[model samples]
Target: ELKVEQNPLFLSMQEGKNYTIYCNYSTTSDRLYWYRQDPGKSLESLFVLLSNGAVKQEGRLMASLDTKARLSTLHITAAVHDLSATYFCAVDQETSGSRLTFGEGTQLTVNP
Candidate 1:
């Protein structure tokens, strides 16, 4: 069975600070993804960690993957109030094609 989990499911952050979100899985897979969502809004893709050691960044957010350890991380740098949102990590089992198993999202509140 494949399982995905994220830590610090509720985060209270201050502007200009840095933090890291972790994603752990119970199975072997090379595909992982990160997404963000505003309250009552749909998810927005942040990064796709396709292979081991793969890293991606956009603005103050960075994501990396380690398939061997079944782990992935989303790093936040110099957070701002506008960056407050719920973040999620998802994994794709190659045999399942387009199906994705998502983690319980991390809700981030960036206060100034």
Candidate 2:
């Protein structure tokens, strides 16, 4: 069965600090995605990595894909209180479009 796991389900981050969130999957996936969700708001897509060695970054967030190892990671650089939110890593399943198995959401708190 396909599964995804994330480290430190709850993170207390300090301002201007850097941290990396790890995501590991159990099955093969052609695409891996990262998303951020603010309280009471719909998720905002962060990164989409396709193929091994794919990487993408925007603002202070970066994500990478390693298909051979069935892993994907979300790295936070220079975290700020404004960046506090819940993050989720997801990957397409053997099924089809937008059908993804997701990790239990990670709650990130960036304190000033």
Best by lDDT: 1
Per-residue lDDT over 14-111 for candidate 1, one digit per residue giving the tens place of the 0 to 100 score: 99999999999999886899999999999999898889999999999999998888999999999999989999999998685687899998999999
Score residue 29 of candidate 1 by CA lDDT. Answer: 83
Model 1, 15: alpha-carbon shift in Å? Answer: 0.4
- Predicted structure 2: lDDT: 0.90
Question: What do the candidate models score in CA lDDT, each in turn?
Answer: 0.93, 0.90
| Candidate 2 structure quality by residue, lDDT tens digits, 9-99 | 9999899999999899998889888989999999899888989999998999989999999888888999989889999999888664568
The regions of model 1 sitting more than 4 angstroms off are none
| Model 2: CA > 4 A from native | none
The TM-score, computed over Cα atoms with residue i paired to residue i, of candidate 1 is: 0.96
Q: For model 2, state the Cα shift of residue 24 in Å.
A: 0.4
